[model samples]
Target: MDRRKSLKIIGGSAIGIAGLVLADWKWQLADQLTHKGFFTFNEENLISSIVDTFIPEGLPPKVPSPDAKPLGGLSTGTDKFLYRLFEHCYEKETQDIVKTQLVNLDERSKSEFGKPFYRLPQGDREKLLISFENSEIEDEVNFFKLMKSQTIMGFTTVKEVMENYRGYKVAPGYFKGCVDMPSQA
Candidate 1:
């Protein structure tokens, strides 16, 4: 081939290789930033739904919350909690354990319920969770406990849960020790 043609071919190959590298790097970076390497889009989505099951939306028209407002999984920052938990709090090994446990849960849900865990009927989902909690497998029991406690902690800590769900108001901290003495005088 001529020099110009050879140059063109080399240029095209270099461009193609560079594009692939850029694309791969972009994908990896996005994955890590999204879930700190513990989850992909689907996995993150599944975890969100899983958290929802644990603390579903308590809204009106069917079954209302005590205050007739929505206060549950979405309000509790369940998705954000999981993302932060795996991203900043947990080690990679713990994250991997959580991921594997969730994967196994989904697979079991698929096999037994004919759908993934998120798609299971509410009753079935609750039953499955209870079974896991009572399971003889030490690891399964531990995973259940961890999931429940983290989710509960996350749910309870959010402002929505504190103010709306629990009906707690911010109290002003003040001391009026001398007011009664002044009145008596």
Candidate 2:
């Protein structure tokens, strides 16, 4: 083959390979997210929303939101991310426990609080959340500690949480040792 023709063929083949690699990577990611072992999208969204709200979304003066940008309110997407991460970290049974407990808690919230767990007014919501925070739910099929820990973990790990609450980044690429961190520090 002529040198120019050979170069063109080689370049084209390289581009094709790159494309395949990218496509495969994306497919794997989607598959992982769409078909987690324990948590379904609905369950995750439900839990994440509760967690975010339980934590609340706001940036203090000179700080930013912890997990995402402060776009007037919270992002449901961050909850999903945290849910996925939690699912990956724990066993299937463990995740199921958390899910079941969350559902139970929602039911309890309805009966005890007289409102949907997520729909209660701010003060009532805060009081209900305080109850959850103070005591772990007991069950043969649930892990209340895991549920509570995961909620806190998901929110606190988010960059927006640090930025908003403490004016910090959860995972800054470079560390600035000299900055005197505040409450979150």
Candidate 3:
């Protein structure tokens, strides 16, 4: 073939290859974004159990009030909140760390108590979490702290907790002016 024809054919082939690679990359990226939020069904259940342990249901009122009904983490959808938070807000490294730690927690529970974390008794679950909190491994300790803080944050921010447990009024019905201010003592 002549030089010009040969060069033209080579350049066209290169462009075609480049276009195919780019299209493939785009499709892969779209697939990842679409599937990103999903965790295995077992993982979801495990997270729910962990959050419930952090704030178990049917806590007694501190002041023995008949009207009080303490809200628990799972009851408030804290586990679902945590899942979204991790998927959307956390960095990829942090998300991976959390997933890894969750698996590790289950493995540790199985080895220690002969059951997965979600199947362990409440007391055993608490004991396992306490061990994580006191663990010398930095990842384990960090995971415990992160889970505890996130669980509490999610539980406290629920609408039921705000209205019932905290007596949080969105708007005060009356705002009395301090007309009769006490004299400076």
User: Per-residue alpha-carbon lDDT of model 3 for 100-181, expressed as tens digits?
Assistant: 9999999998899899899988999999999999999999999999999998999888988877667888896978886797
Please, what is the whole-model Cα lDDT of each candidate in the order they appear? 0.78, 0.63, 0.86
What are the models' TM-scores?
0.65, 0.51, 0.69
Error of 1 at 37 (Å): 5.5
Tens-place lDDT digits, model 1, residues 61-168:
443244566767766678777777877898877777788888878888888889988777778888888888999987778888988888878888888656755667
Give the Cα error of residue 116 in candidate 1, in Å: 1.3
Candidate 2 lDDT at 151 equals 63
Better of 1 and 2 by lDDT: 1
- 57-150: candidate 2 lDDT, tens digit per residue: 6543543334544421245255666567666877776666677766766777789877666666667755655666666445522344555566
Mark the 10 consecutive residues where model 1 has the least summed lDDT.
Answer: 59-68
- Model 3 TM: 0.69
lDDT of 3 at 104: 94
What are the runs in model 2 whose C-alpha is more than 4 Å off?
A: 1-42, 64-73, 136-145, 159-185
